[model samples]
Target: MRLARFRHDGRVRTGVVEGDHVLPFEGDPGMLEIIDGSAEQRTAGPVPLDDVKLMAPLQPRTLRDFVAFEEHVEGVRRSIDGSSGVPEAWYDAPTFYFTNPHRVYGPDDDIPFPARSVDRDFELEVAVIAGPEQSIFGYTILNDWSARDLQRREMQVSLGPAKGKDFASTLGPWIVTADELDPYHEEGFLDLWCTAQVNGVEVGRDLLSNMGWTFETLIAYAARDSRVMAGDVLGSGTVGNGGCLAELWGRNGKQDPPPLRDGDVVTLTVDGIGSLTNRVVTGPQTGDLPPVRRRDQAQARAERQH
Candidate 1:
């Protein structure tokens, strides 16, 4: 079953997506809101999916993204220096980040380009949204929009990814339950094609099976020392050989990083997982953009940027 959170009338509630409509899951809030409820007992309201705005299915209590793919890790490192690869410890330890939940956006939203970013690029990934606590539910397409310039600057200072990666991280039109994609995790060849389209033009593409680490390993590592709540989200950093900018933009080492311009639409689509489409817009400004108003606007804005 595919799950989502959306707005109807004036309230924001969680729902399940079936075919062309959205089924309202009115119970508790967050992942637990739907995870804890039964689909058999769910009395759904049919809202034309086109009319309802989609939000991230789970309101992640703790959002942590891991670098499960060694190829991606190595590519990023190589881009930084002549030769940079994943350390032995990285294979042993599950590396993660505490991202701002406020930064997460829904499936069809438009990601905003921070004022600081000049070069904004996309990272195509398959993020695993945990089922109950430590269980690996299934995978969803992820677009980790990056500001190359800021990231490089911060890395130079050795206190990186702040502000650079904090701007936005996109996830899901629906959280594909593990059962649906069963054999992929265990038996048969779980081959799925993934691609990225910028304003209808293909910019990147990759295969789901190309990653170095499996989803099962990610789950075990994530739950190793700590407890992952029902609504928590874990992201698969990026995929092999596909770089929206690291290779395309030459790592911003040569010149100014390219920022996402207004009207640029980025679509990260996976075979069974569906497409995660978003537009790029400028963040809100002062004068009329108050602090509280900005944050509120950001949240609302995030819903559309996804």
Candidate 2:
């Protein structure tokens, strides 16, 4: 089943998409309702899809995105640090980071590039929403927006992708139930054809099979000493090779094609799952920010934790 969340008649609603129309669910069942198998009932008839404004599929309980592709890691390292190989520890296990679930965008939405950063990039990926028993409820296209300049500074602190990434994420058009993707699944990995484009020009294309770790491994690794509840969303990080603009191919870590700018449109598409597109816009205003204090004026010693 393909389910979508949209705004119709001045109200946000949940519905099932069939062809060119949408069948609104009774009482606006959401992600939780569908996952629990309770979103079966629907309104009397179907409504044309053009009547509603689509929204980001769901607001996840937790968002965890992983670097599950070796080629992506290698390319990113070369782009950012002028490095040649991935860290050995990366192969030890699938690693991920928590991103803000509150800020999300849907298809056709305008994505504001972070005002403080000059380098803008987009990551093409697929994200799965967890259902009952931590199983995948559905799949959707994900565009992880990035401000590479902020990311570079943040990572230098050895504790980041926070200020850089917590800005925004795009998901939707609709969610395709897991069973619908069975034809593409092979040994816990999907062989989906994925592609990314900016301003109608193709930037990258890759197969999901190129990922270094499977969703199962990501889920299991995430569950270590923690619970992965329903509604949690996990991303299959940037697809390897030329999956993102940050994959530099220049001397001294310089970006070749340059970063995204205002008026650029980014679209990510995956076979079976559909596509998600957003336009770049000027973000909110910037305010005065104080830099870190000098080392001499820094704290003499670390304080004990509470």
lDDT for each candidate structure:
0.70, 0.85
lDDT of 2 by residue, 1-306 (tens): 898989999988888889999988888877677776767766647989888899998888888999998888888877775678889999898899999998988999998877888888999999988887878788898898988888888888788788788889999989999999999988879999999988898878999988888787788788888999878889999997568988754232567777899999999999998889999886888888899676642444443321
lDDT of 1 at 249: 38
Worst 10 residues of 2 by lDDT: 297-306
**Which candidate has the top score in TM-score?**
2
lDDT of 1 by residue, 197-237 (tens): 77887766777776556766667777777777666777776
Model 2 lDDT on a 0 to 1 scale: 0.85
For all predicted structures, in order, the TM-scores are 0.81, 0.93
Error of 1 at 69 (Å): 2.4
The residue-level lDDT of candidate 2 at 55 comes to 94
Write down the RMSD of all candidates, one decimal each: 10.2, 2.8
Say which candidate scores most in lDDT.
2
Decoy 1 TM-score against native:
0.81
